[model samples]
Target chain A: DVKVTQSSRYLVKRTGEKVFLECVQDMDHENMFWYRQDPGLGLRLIYFSYDVKMKEKGDIPEGYSVSREKKERFSLILESASTNQTSMYLCASSPPYLATQYFGPGTRLTVL
Target chain B: SQQGEEDPQALSIQEGENATMNCSYKTSINNLQWYRQNSGRGLVHLILIRSNEREKHSGRLRVTLDTSKKSSSLLITASRAADTASYFCATDSGDDMRFGAGTRLTVKP
Candidate 1:
């Protein structure tokens, strides 16, 4: 069974603080993604990594950055957390050439 | 930008009834997928239909895709209370996949 695990199920941070959300997958997938879910925005991709040390920005990547130093781990970093960044953060991974992405339980981030 | 948009943002149905939701995308896609998310949980991959295919089915879920119209539909038969969740449609193009604002389904027992 493919499993994706997030570092935290919930988190709260103050404005201007740095935040990090981690995701790990056991399936050795080549593609990993980060997204933020809002009430009306759905899942908007923040960043994606196709291979180790390779990253691509999605539609909304201005306030976030990503790290993929290894194949099994992907991390999302917020330079300066703001209230507007508070949302349900999700991580997903998929095998090479596969469109089906397995997701980890989201982290509900609250930036106060 | 969002690629897919689902119609009927919210739906309410009773147990044993069939529920249907529609999704329309703006661009050509390689494949379309359906996902379900229970409250406060991660999204679960439900089904995937390639652009060349018209319909596919799982236990109680049926998905139909229309490439020419750039749209798709998902039908859940004999929906139970456990089926209540937010259903999302996603389109895959190249290496990128985008999701639509989901349709929240409420099944009243």
Candidate 2:
């Protein structure tokens, strides 16, 4: 079975604080993705990595950065958390060419 | 920018009834997939229809794609209360995936 796990199910952070959301996949997939979901915005991609040590920006990546130091782990970092950044963060991983993504439980971030 | 948009932003239906949701996308796509997300949870891939295919089915879920119109529809037969969730359509053209806003479906028991 393919399993993706996130570091936290919920988190609260103050403005200007650095926040990190971690995701790990057991399927050994080469592609990993980060997205933020808002009420009307649905799932907006933040960043994605096609290979280890490689990252690409998505539609909404201005306030977010991602790291892929290892194949199984991907990390999303918010350099300065703001109230606007409070949203549900989702992580997904998939194999190359297949494009079927398996998602984690998600982290609900609350930036106060 | 979002490449897909789902119509009927929300839907409510009784158990044993069929539920249908529509999705429309812009630009060309190699494939389209349907995903379901429970409250405050991550998404689960439901089904995928390739560009050349017009329809596909899995268990109770039926997906139909119309590439000429850049639209697709997902129909769930005899839905159960457990089927209540947000349904999203995603389009991918070999690189990354783009998701729609999703349709909130509520199935009453």
Residue-level lDDT of model 2, residues B15-86, one tens digit each, is 999999999998899999999999999999999999999999999999999999999999999999999999
Task: List DockQ for all candidates.
Answer: 0.88, 0.82
lDDT of each candidate versus the true structure:
0.96, 0.95
Q: Give the per-residue lDDT digits (tens) of candidate 1, residues A27-53.
A: 999999999999988999999999999
Taking the tens digit of each residue's C-alpha lDDT, what string does model 1 give over B34-97? Answer: 9999999999999999999999999999999999999999999999999999999999987589
Query: What TM-score results for chain B in every one of the models?
Result: 0.98, 0.98
The superposed Cα distance between candidate 2 and the true structure at residue A32, in angstroms, equals: 0.3
Clash totals for all models, in order? 0, 0
Displacement of residue B59 (Cα, Å) in model 1 is: 1.0
